[model samples]
Target: MIYFVYQILPHNCRSVRSILCSSLFLQKKGKKGAKAVEEEPVQVDAKDRIDFDSAKQKLQAVVDRFAKYANDAKLGKTSPKVFDNLMVQTDHGDQPYTSLAQTSIKGRNFIMTVYDPANIQRIINSVLGSGLNLNPVVDPSNKLTLKMPLPPITTELKNESVKELKNVYEKLRNGASLGKNHTLSSIRADARHKLTKNKKLDNLETEVWNEYEKLHKIYVSKLSEMIKAAETAIMK
Candidate 1:
């Protein structure tokens, strides 16, 4: 006689009938008689489960990194370092703004001393298109010098800054979400591979998803609050 056995599968696992198989089968008689079939039960290891605490710790690390960046961005201050990595389009191609000119602060204004007089127009174009909202004009006496005045915070500038902040927030949020989803998928796949039972594996997945959602909300809300505070600081 043949006997079929089936094992419960977790969510995203194979169909119920997929694991159904004949545990006992008749053996063909050779010259004497038929041989008896033997059956053995499959056992699942209790230790194979999701490491949720480790996953949570990794997610927290990402949040901490972004938290510091958000904190540094809270205050609206003009500094020469702001232009450290500013890329400018040049005849040779894109290049760092600092490499093309020297930046110095005169009170609230930025004085740019270009290396070459011929590249004055190019530098001015870079600043105007830099999305920094600063207007650069050539000094009357010195053609090689550009004077950029830091305009007092206005409604228009504040709005621009907030828009930029939102862009940054979206990127960070999306990146974290992708990482979380990838990790969850890996967990689900491993459970399925081990043929874990439905109840236990499903429960573990639910808990992991809840934890990820909680962390996502916390970080997202924190970033939003920081952006709003930055907008307020710009208006002050």
Candidate 2:
């Protein structure tokens, strides 16, 4: 989900000013020989759940890294490549984006996706300007936050989309029964191609995606309710 439009800035010389400055000292010694120095990572607690305080600290560390001017000379304007160096991940895998900082030039949109799907949600939740980080607007994954508020779709529209997807799915079933080689990708691709060719397809694509999202949410909500009902029955 897209969040936070930021004004592009210039003059980023702050990279030189490294953090934890208090640890560094002026050790001017005789015959100063320089060798590589490996810094230690800031440690966190072994708690299972993430504490908000700890989350805030981690967020600050992220901000500090990207807090440089949007147009730093070292990091060319509109280049999200620099964040690749930073190893950001979630329990599942590396995050889709570390920090998605976007800037538009004139009219063309220059978007920077951090692709750190692992930590993507935490960062986006933090960036959304919300005081509290609720689970997620749409939890694509533990790391990825599909943060946009779900578009309000009429019941008719939802029904129609379900019908359409089912119809397409039926075609896939029919094709398979005929011994015509058909895979999920093949079916989806065929359906996608047809949808893409439609005159009002852009609108249709959004509605269709929304319908899928709604169905998924419904499944999860209903599944949980069913589980609770079953548990109660068992207890009785």
Candidate 3:
């Protein structure tokens, strides 16, 4: 009965004519029907093929994310046996638990049929955060290796320091001959050359001279006029 239905002619709505002509009835009439009732030329549904392709694409993306999201922490779950099994699904590091395992289907089929875009994104973020922030010592064997952040410089001090740095280098090179490299020892030695001279505003980089700028200015203002007047009296 079933074979007879498939052999019906396709000329009408049900192709009943062909079906009957190709079945047992046809054999009685001396025209042998085709051996097989199922035809290979059945038209496939466009939507189904599209749906499958789309599903496959989505599943692949999820599996790829799952692969990338592999890490060691996920494998070290409380259940050692489960860890042993799931660990094979991923590479190294703390691989996160995937929903695919919860599905009744096999792991590979879940990897193929599963579609979870948001979960994939979450897994990617998880992978990003899973990496350990390494803090290696500059010299591990030294037993005292440390890296400290430098203190921030004030704007005014930074500008002044920059200006003075050039003069400090030049003094170091040229003043080397006079033993005036501007170090504490060099400056103290130079100071001994004068008995009671005012601090000079010389090396721009040296803050010690800057410390005396105000006092030097005040003295020069108050004494410049009197010294000139006394000089005139002596000359006359």
Candidate 4:
């Protein structure tokens, strides 16, 4: 028995397909009483050849990150979730707020119960530095507990949040577009590499572009819808 392993990366989709076909060929040759044919042409299955799904999956990841930011980019209300994944500069390194402490909602305020009593000041400094205008107060006797008062929402603050939201949206949108183009270029290069050895694979490049365009439109539309929804939520 022979085995081949591939480490699937973002750009190696085509290479994996080729390897799978080769593996199938090997398996067929290994059967008892089977004869190995010289220079057998391995058929690349159409179902296996399409990589746009993977590309779209990667694109969705970018959009998802943006969506999280968008969700937190509002001035209307305060939730403990707003502090999720907030990177705090620590003596060791940068760490997420959730890693340092557990947060919960106490009426309109966000409460944090630190895991380490000594980390109280670190958590406090992080919340103060978050730019979310959360002024955290320590529970005098209970040093491990901290409470943050959610700022009162105002028209001016809402406008500022919306402005920041638009800025972040534009930046992420532009970056995603560039990333999409780069991925398309990489897929094109892979197609060309394979086509040079086999002209029968000429249609491979066309299929790649077609599939990419379809998925591209889907994700682009999704991002647009997200921004519009976010803006509406913030302004309302």
Q: What would the TM-score be for candidate 3 when compared with the true structure? A: 0.16
lDDT of 3: 0.32
Better of 1 and 3 by lDDT: 1
When superposed on Cα atoms, how far off is each prediction in RMSD?
A: 16.0, 34.8, 39.1, 18.9
Q: Per-residue lDDT for 129 in model 4?
A: 85
TM-score of 1: 0.48
Q: Please identify which of the two predictions, 1 or 2, would achieve the higher TM-score against the true structure.
A: 1
Cα error of candidate 3 at position 78, Å: 14
Ranking by lDDT: 4, 1, 2, 3
Best lDDT goes to which candidate?
A: 4
What's the TM-score of each model vs. the native?
A: 0.48, 0.17, 0.16, 0.55
How far off is residue 230 in model 3, in Å?
84
| Every candidate's lDDT | 0.62, 0.37, 0.32, 0.69
lDDT assessment of candidate 1: 0.62
TM-score of 4: 0.55
lDDT of 1 by residue, 64-147 (tens): 655555554443336555667778788899888888899888888888898987778888888878777888898898888899
State the lDDT of candidate 4 residue by residue for 99-211, as single tens digits.
88988877877788989876788888887887777878888867889987777878787787778777766766553345543332344344345434555534655675466
Model 1's C-alpha root-mean-square deviation from the true structure amounts to 16.0
- The TM-score-based order of candidates, best leading, equals 4, 1, 2, 3
Q: Which model, 2 or 3, shows the larger TM-score?
A: 2
Residue 92 of model 3 has an lDDT of 50
